[model samples]
Target: MPAKDKMDKTKMVTCTAPVNIAVIKYWGKRNEELILPINSSLSVTLHQDQLKTTTTVAVSRSFQDDRIWLNGKEEDIAHPRLQSCLREIRRLARKRRNDGAAGLDSTGLSHKVHICSVNNFPTAAGLASSAAGFACLVYTLAQVFGVEGELSGIARQGSGSACRSMYGGFVQWIMGNTDDGKDSLAQQVEPETHWPELQILVLVASAERKPVGSTSGMQTSVQTSCLLKHRAESVVPGRMVEMIEAVRKKDFPAFAELTMKDSNQFHATCLDTYPPIFYLNRVSQQVINLVHRYNRHYGETRVAYTFDAGPNAVIFTLRQHVSEFVHVVQHFFPPETNGGDFIKGLPVNHTALSEELKQGIGLEPMPKGVSYIISTKVGPGPCVVEDPSQHLLASDGLPKECV
Candidate 1:
């Protein structure tokens, strides 16, 4: 009788989105609230298996109010970015209904939604969690409300970097000149299959929240840093063209050079800010020095390093260079002796480090500086989880057995 009486009326959809590391960083915002960037940026979307956000959205008439749970904890649904994503999805659904699109769920449209999002990686680790987070939220919500198409523009309103995570492979976010930001959207320069051997490694320096968030930090840079203005106007345009060509040709050397330089300049602008922001520490500088020495030792650019808003190093290298370069890293920043998942994703084949190679690039070992590394490669965009059991929320519209 209980089962018969309580047939669930909830509708739900679940999806996952990968985090994007900006090779050409997006630092300053031209328009703050809309998240319009001062300069366009390019990035490689890493595989979801290693790092991503999984979100589930549920709509039910029985729910008391619209709510959300982030990593098994309740959070305010009215946070501006979250609110923007929720509002836009509903608006699109309303338009589809007014236009009489087939399979319209008018009843579900009126129901409140409960959103649950969890990341495969740590939330405040400065690994672009918000980008994947918002992208997944917008995507799953669209599926629940029966509205879809061109959601990146809406995702951009949630987080600037988020637009890039809407697609996979090599992506570029074109900073549009229009006031309404219609043209400012993400475009895939190449699909994941374009380059099979390209690999990404995340050298975790620390798993902690940044002292300053990107929004406020960049705002200070925009107002105070002249380097940022010059970089936006005179530098990024030409670099965008060169970066796109490098990806198209699979020119690792060219791509590596550009990626490293852009990352440096982005951090440079941060230092030039009035109060002066510092994202890199002693560990970061050591990693940068090691990368240069390694390339010099090989007489070519075999590896490149980029840093986001935190101290962690995101290294880009080809398959041929992976084992040796990883060997270099492990030798310099030895993992904990107690044991952990030192490498998270693809297995790193054990390779011997020759004395000739080690002494050639001479650097003092900095034990335990890096927590671990995540070995991954270019991967596809956001995806749907068709299985019912994957849902993060239950038919009762609460977190589904979350511990």
Candidate 2:
């Protein structure tokens, strides 16, 4: 093959992005295309070692069409939400090309993206898999196209909460008022370096998939739940201010109060929906009650608990208190439904677990299939990695190690 002919082959770029957990949750969207949230939300981006996705995107002449391989499996590229993100990034890259000497070669800028992503944890583990996936997708694309501008804007199209994942540590997704959703993007409140002592404990109630997805669940809540209207109109506005201040001061009690309240309200809104969607399972409820009782007994809030669109609970505690929290919760995880039988059973989700959790913490082994846990902390925003060969796609723009 001639040198020019060989150079006609496609090129690839690989990037990795971390997952994030919202302190101020984004439950609904005002604009689907732009992924404009109904209200602003706040989150703590986790360290990459704890929970993250590594995605490699490639663009090449040898590829036939846009395709995706999620965790080594081919998935249809038909979701409008996913496509909206990719489309926006491509549009921006092309716009940059129109300006001379933007540094990106015109030929490379025009290449179609073929993305392949894999999470370090189980996608079925009831964690925020999509959050990491979409965030990584947009972050990686920005690297491939060499686009200029704040990446948070691009991540918004992928997932409203994902904008926060573009940065690590403390982040806020500002709900911009513009009709185009240009100003409604994420911003860094503080870097991880500022609060290096914060800790997160994921209490995996059940590894099973969530009963309802956040997108559809939020839509149902919006249409049927009057309480949701009240939250959007009344509650979140004030809580947002409070949460920000709490983070700035490193005030755990204030942060815990606001987080617990916000989570309860979110769940309540889910219940308010007609034919009400139930995201929390019995085990989940048990966990909540246990946390509430622990706080009451301690006479102060040492830890905060929140749930996304799943039964699994994500707990936020100061690094100083993490050991105590873990010690107390560990006893609640018994290996069997009851003693001596040794038959593995799921963790008890009964409402009467207040006494059990307090007295039983660390005494029992976690019940079989009862839980999976990941301990992690706040992380930094998205970054541009220089190596394109690290991506999941091969030189030919096909997924590496596909089934």
Candidate 3:
């Protein structure tokens, strides 16, 4: 009998993964191939409703070869990282089949796959798009192949931060000490409900691609920056412990302070790199200043800001303070009046800015400095979509969006 006779006409799976913002950033790599980090890092997984990547993977014997489309455009399927994920998932499926695992789709193991993925937010603009993308790809592929258990290590091979995206709520990526990278994986510190009042606002300074990609920038930082070396060895280990504690205790001030400090140090290491990689722009600096000034005015840390490999500012604050803080952001970095809804995602109640608050901030208003804000909260990890209508690929094993 042909392989088609032993298998269903098509086996497909769809999944969505959320973007994660590292509070204790992951910078350099110990091993480039495995994408192992120099130090352990922690991040908050943003709600999928506000930001996410949806991916569909279909397997069929009729397909001649493997193919992929990203955001409605076909991409090179031979890309090395993509190959790593594909190879590993198939290898796992074969192993399980040989072991006589129940519910294994034996015939589909040899079939070709077609993958279609798209992000709700901007890609490569330092919004952790790769983290969500790779996580979703690995997850959707596993679902189709009936492979289960510990897949974060496989996701890490695609993108360093991708490992952390495997879990929900507050997660930590432990930089394991191993040559083969068998131990470097992500674990959740807390669930999405751990801190219900916690809120995240993404200030999109620019949606365009960053001047320096995180991969190249990190390679350079490892080569030249002594500060980066010092940070990896001495700094991050202690902060990881403290961050976990703060999360567990629900201590907002401690969490905010550690977050801001880590972000500052991460950027400092970038500057210490030879030829100095610059990710933050003038608008980013203004955001930083505004955050500190706003906190100082209240005599406490009400909000904190962190920037990853790009100019976008991700702010962490409490639900009680979100409305006012947003108003403050509007006052300092006025959006274009013609711009549709300056705030996106979760709704924010309108709060009038006080004259005293404005004077306390006392910064020159930079009109349209920030493109817009995405208001979201901590949420779950990769999830399967039960509805067949949501699949990105149709029954013929092709992207639905492709004409």
lDDT of 3: 0.94
Backbone collision count in every prediction?
0, 14, 0
Q: What global local distance difference test value does model 1 have?
A: 0.91
- Native-vs-model 2 lDDT? 0.76
TM-score of each: 0.97, 0.89, 0.98
Stretches of candidate 2 off by over 4 Å are 1-6, 124-126, 335-357, 360-370, 385-389
Each model's lDDT: 0.91, 0.76, 0.94
Look at candidate 1 and tell me the lDDT of residue 46: 93
Give candidate 3's total backbone clashes.
Answer: 0
1-403: candidate 2 lDDT, tens digit per residue: 9977765766666667887878788888777777788888888888887688988877775566788989888898987878888888878878877766445766765555688889986574457787788888888887777776787877777777778888888888889899998899888888898777678888767766677777788888878889988898798889889999999998889998898889888889899999798888877776787687677777778888998877878888877776556545554555333433321122222233356446643233334423445678887766656865465766666776752
lDDT of 1 by residue, 95-135 (tens): 99999999787887777888899998877668999999998
Candidate 2 colliding pairs, count: 14
Tens digit of per-residue lDDT, candidate 3, span 160-195: 999999999999999999999999999999999999
Q: Is candidate 2 or candidate 3 better by TM-score?
A: 3
RMSD of each: 1.9, 5.1, 1.5
